[model samples]
Target: MLPLALLAGVATQLRAEEPRPAATTDFAGLILHLSEDPGKFHSDNFVSNEPGYPSAIEGLRALGIHGGAYIGVGPEQNFSYLAALQPERAFVVDIRRENTVQHLMYKALFAAARNRLEFLELLLSRPPPNAPEGESSRAAMSVQELLTAVDSRGASMKACEQTIDSVSARIEENFGFPLTDKDRVTLRHIHSAFAEAGLSIHYSSPKAVKQEPTLRELMLARDTYGNHVHFLASEKDFQFVKQLHARDRIVPVTGDFAGRQALRKAGEFVRDRGEVVSAFYLSNVEQYLRGAQYAAFVENVRRLPLNDRSVLIRCAFEKPTQRLPGDHSEQADGQFWPHALLLQRAQRFVELYDEGAFLTHEDLARQDYLDWTSGR
Candidate 1:
């Protein structure tokens, strides 16, 4: 019963002295280690920032992925999902070394950018908008508005190339991540791809594949309930991812989702920190995995610290009429669509492994994960 002001001051001091949660791993050191010792797997070049399946957002939200830790295979879509989940930490795992380099490029940009508008400006190497004089004012612009401004003042080829090189140099010199000549070339190519295409870059563009949705379309995509689900759809979501990147919480590792090294190490890090993996986003990687690879992936997942609430969000391409053993026949839609489904990791591992059902994508897809929440 001393003075009330004295008691308040003591309380503030105690709160200030409280211990914070230690980082599970040194982010930069871990990236350097993983890049130096990559897992034994190969993935083809996927330079575009566009996601293969934009509909995964529906499944992710349906599963109630709130955030602890997120591990995913792919490019920019992982960032989009991360924005939605607001995970405490994130790891982008891919088999391709170039993918890791691409992520590092993104990290450098994120670190360099002051806000979402500035991020897009730096990404495409376009000059910032003239109207917005300060960071606060520039950040007030919507994602779409920012894109429009950049699109209006397109970068020339020489300018774009120079910008790419400057950013690459910043990553190597300032960030302290050494880049090989080959890595620099690949990084330049990636940055050029974005600059050339602007917001309309797609997975199939310039490569001249069939019709594909642009990155802008994917970012503007809505969930099953017709809500805008893309990360850049809201200012809060964009800031959420940007803040995480600024904190060095979003780590990019060069490891296959089904590989031995990356996932195992990620699991160990999460376990060491006494944290649970909230969700793992498998974006149609199972379609390409062989039987043994699938098994190894499942085992790797099993090693992660997970609770009953942990979920696996999977993307698959299948016709509505295609049926597997024990798969229920629903109304024929007569079209192939990318379907996103969720499964409890512990439960699915036991069921699929025991039944020897990991042989094919169809085998995994046929299972009745309908009991679990899913959107599309």
Candidate 2:
């Protein structure tokens, strides 16, 4: 079972990140649709760090659109990318500080709840020598036992609700943004969407607690540290390129190297000059940056560079556990992890672009399992 201390930390991290819309002086109804996997869609829709998932940069160049109120691809993704994409777009929110407290609170509550579930697993399992006395050894359950257990579980769930409430309250007190039920539901909806879409919820853990913390912290820290000095310091660079093209009324091309190359050449003619923001799984970095994998990416890029300018890449971090979908093994049936599929599609894109990058990809879960069994 996970340590109680870890559970608390996870909850803390979540509440820190989640946003409470009602709490803000002004609300921007910006629905950020993240790509669970960039490769899943055609190259014309989404601009992601990965090879597939549609090219946001090209989309901007092709669409001749700039700032918007609704949902659709645009130039400037996260904060840094926004600066480079449209140094003029002022409505951008520094996502890190935007709803941090609420985000962290939700995460912590989830962590605590998950830990309780893990502990219950131990308690309800077949009793062994280490098992507490009077606990049943059999996995099978009688009708009464089952019903009673269900009641107990219901109580536990209620406790979980309280935990979240407490955290939310704390967030309100600290950040001056009190979370209303509506705000909580919206956040939950986003989490549900990510899970349903099969994309990994990167922020489903307390990053600060990890031995090798996920990249979310690195990116956020870099931005926070360099906020005053550099606009694109830590934000991924792909969005910047897209925004720049959008502002110039450049049309973006999505799909196939020939079309993209044509777009790139066109961008130059239209005075295309802007930063590119992109991200990728850490496992596939070698494919884009160096070694044989890099060569493969080059081969693909030669065919289609997607965007027309300078690019920046940043790593994403994992979120607290509860904010993440339930364990995949359970197949609880409500929602599937969309991020996983998103990444899988992204892998496909890399393969389409440069098979070398695809070859370098690694599964984080597989590694974790190996490490655990081998006591690594």
Which ten-residue region of model 1 has the weakest summed lDDT? 1-10
Cα lDDT for residue 64, model 1?
Answer: 72
In candidate 1, stretches whose alpha carbon ends up further than 4 angstroms from where it belongs are 1-26, 35-55, 128-143, 205-209, 322-346, 370-376
* Per-model TM-score versus the true fold: 0.78, 0.23
Model 2 Cα lDDT, one tens digit per residue, 1-376? 1111111111122232444344331111111211010111111111122111112222222333233211112221333324323433222111122222223333333332222222222222211233223323222333233223433421233434444455465445543445556556644443333222221123332432422211122122221112321222212232343334234222212111112232233223323334221221121222124344345334433432233222212121222233211111211124222221111122234344443323332322221110111221
Query: Candidate 2: worst 10 consecutive residues by lDDT?
Result: 34-43
Query: Each prediction's Cα lDDT score?
Result: 0.63, 0.26
Highest lDDT: which candidate? 1
